[model samples]
Target: MDENEKDRILKVEIDVSGKLHLTPEKKKFTLIYRTATEVHWNTEINTLYSPKPRDWTYLEWFKHIIKVTKEECYCELNITEQTEWVNIPNELKKEITKAQQWL
Candidate 1:
């Protein structure tokens, strides 16, 4: 995927129902939650492709699976009141900042 697509994905948010909410357009996408092991096995079987193979971290895998499934969005399971900000990737951070300006 290109930088634009990646940024789009990064701008998404998860709603209370565990659904992914896309930005600007406010489109909702369903997610098929998968374990890291499942993703790994799928990759091994050629059922999935890492967008960034060199940096095939769990987050990348999550993004890749979401893109491939063509789902609306992803919500990290087990979110709580104490949920904290994840370490946003530099590229994604830029997108978030840009997105905030429109709010």
Candidate 2:
């Protein structure tokens, strides 16, 4: 992976209001965004999923329920920096390197 791409500022708009409105059994945390390259996606999943359209109500199956009901979520990336070189973890570096090798 290019060092320049590490800190690429991607926009992700997550709408959790629907899930929060559902009953415990009927509702769960689901990914509101679907475009892998558009929004930062988990490369771990193999299938290419459709981008969650604006009018679409239910979320894609790829999305999983949030394990915790807690209000605080730290998983959201800290994107205050304008520089194009975010520090990534060693595991992600390995994954990025591996992906780059195929190119």
Candidate 3:
């Protein structure tokens, strides 16, 4: 696989509510988002990283999960810093404002 394909294999997205989502690039539209509640602590997130098992030992899988998650996080952080928000959804903005009142 090319670099782009490798990078695109897994992604992390943030929602208006500051919720994190894990989705594959091609299936981003179909899979949409998998919220924390929807993800199983062990199995689901690993599956999101790679649907098929990699024949890795338990420790290997653990290390891979940490490495990939960190890489994706850093990738997002850089992209977010460089990009500008052209438009913010008013409804979600308002919802956030209203929710912030509780704090």
Could you report the Cα RMSD, in angstroms, for every candidate shown?
12.3, 16.5, 14.0
For model 3, residues 13-75, the per-residue Cα lDDT tens digits are 333443333443332222312432122222343223322224543223323433444343222
In model 2, the Cα lDDT at residue 3 comes to: 22
The whole-model lDDT of each prediction reads 0.34, 0.26, 0.32
lDDT of 3: 0.32
- Candidate 2 local lDDT, residue 53: 41
Q: Residue 45 deviation, candidate 1, in Å?
A: 32
Deviating ranges (above 4 Å) for candidate 1: 1-25, 31-59, 71-86, 91-103
- lDDT string for model 1 (1-103, tens) is 3222222332334334333332322222322235432232122222232333344543444454444344323322221223233444567545444543332
Q: Score every model by TM-score.
A: 0.24, 0.20, 0.23
Candidate that would win on lDDT:
1
Q: Compared to the true structure, candidate 1 yields what TM-score?
A: 0.24
lDDT accuracy of residue 1 in candidate 3: 21
Better of 2 and 3 by TM-score: 3
Candidate 1 lDDT score at position 11: 32
Q: Give the per-residue lDDT digits (tens) of candidate 2, residues 1-103.
A: 1221112223212233221111122122244233122222233421122334444422321122111112122122212223122233455434433433332
Q: What is the Å distance of residue 75 in model 1 from its true position?
A: 16
